[model samples]
Target: MLLLTIDSSAGASVALTRDGAPLDAWRTEQTTSHAEVLAPAVQRMMIGAGVTGADLDGVAVGVGPGPFTGLRVGLALAHALAEAWRKPLHGICSLDSLALRATDAGVEGEFLVATDARRREVYWAQYIRDEKGSRLVRGPFGASATDLPELPAVGAGLGLYPQELRPATMDEDPSAWVPDAAELGQLAEGALVGELHGVLCQARPLYLRESDAQVPVQMRQGGS
Candidate 1:
């Protein structure tokens, strides 16, 4: 099966795969550049891999526990591609993809996958690796550093998170911290087997908290 995976959940990523073998994968640091970079990357990946929209069997996108703007870039792109090509679209959680990347990097024991969510909070989840696979234990929630469960060999999207969230065993690789589109494709393959539901429409970006900027200011003096 040929699949295209896009992940703008943390860093922007685009990957092409055939029968689970990665044909091409591209990821770039785009702290706030998703709007400008995602599409071009998609087009470039297609060209680099010698594939076209029509050649893809499915599309896998990282639905996020991320900042609103970047998350939308990927989700919108995936939706547009799915609609245009009339192909099955799958959504994978951005945090799950990060955790998968961490595990693939040789992380053992429980893990606390985290991404910075500015304003002194982070998007985080706790997972435990088992015979089946890693399962979420803490949250897909945004929390202050104090709120996360004990970190475990933590990695993935660290700049989007707080320093205190790093575990004692942390194997920090800011580069590896971002989600892997190739891994996203692999997860999509697993989901296709009915191991997990692959609902494109129901796939919502998991923003754990509303933007801090959106919070209404309270009067210190008294009610306004």
Candidate 2:
């Protein structure tokens, strides 16, 4: 199946995939520019692949435990495109994509996947890969880096708190280790094939914490 995938959990990334294999991909590590860069990145990938929304079988997105602003940018676009194209929308955990990357890179046994959650914390999960595939074993929790267990960890969290989170040998350089749309697409494909039941979810934002934005006290009290 041909799929267009997007992720803004860390930075912004988009990809075109066919039967779980990447056809083309684009990314930018500028976190704050997801709103500006994500759509164009998708357009560039689709054009490069010589396909359009109509040619896609579905849309896959990283429904993230990321900051509210970045996650909304990607999820909103994915929702709009899916609705317009009348295609199924699949949501893969952004942390799962990171685990896939580590597994593909040959990290062994159980390990942790984490990404920067800002405010000196991280969004983290544990996984183990075997003959079947990578399986989430522990968390999708949000906590300070120092609070995370000392497992060999991969993802942007390593870059932020290398001293606290042990860096997996395969992912020593975590600077560029954000969730990839292509990897997210692969996981979605696995679910479509029934190999990953319960892994894919509805196309919705997975914000693990409450939004920083809040109504003022006067507004809540009906004072206008």
Off by over 4 Å in 1: 156-163, 168-176, 194-201, 212-224
lDDT (C-alpha, whole model) for all candidates:
0.74, 0.87
- Candidate 2 structure quality by residue, lDDT tens digits, 72-151: 99999999999999999988898888888888889888899989999999999989888776789877889999898878
Pairs clashing within candidate 2: none
Cα lDDT of candidate 1 equals: 0.74
Per-residue lDDT of 137 in model 1: 71
Structural similarity to truth (TM-score) of each candidate: 0.83, 0.95
With a 3 Å backbone cut-off (N, CA, C), the pairs that clash in candidate 1 are 115-160, 116-160, 116-161, 156-177, 157-177
For model 1, state the Cα shift of residue 72 in Å.
0.5
The residue-by-residue lDDT of candidate 1 on 1-224, one tens digit each, is 89999888777888888776789988887668988988898898888878888898999988887888888888899889988999988888777776677677666678787777767776777877777666667667777767776655354435444455554243456424666688888777767766644323245677676654554456554557
Highest-lDDT candidate: 2
Model 1 alpha-carbon miss at residue 25, Å: 0.9
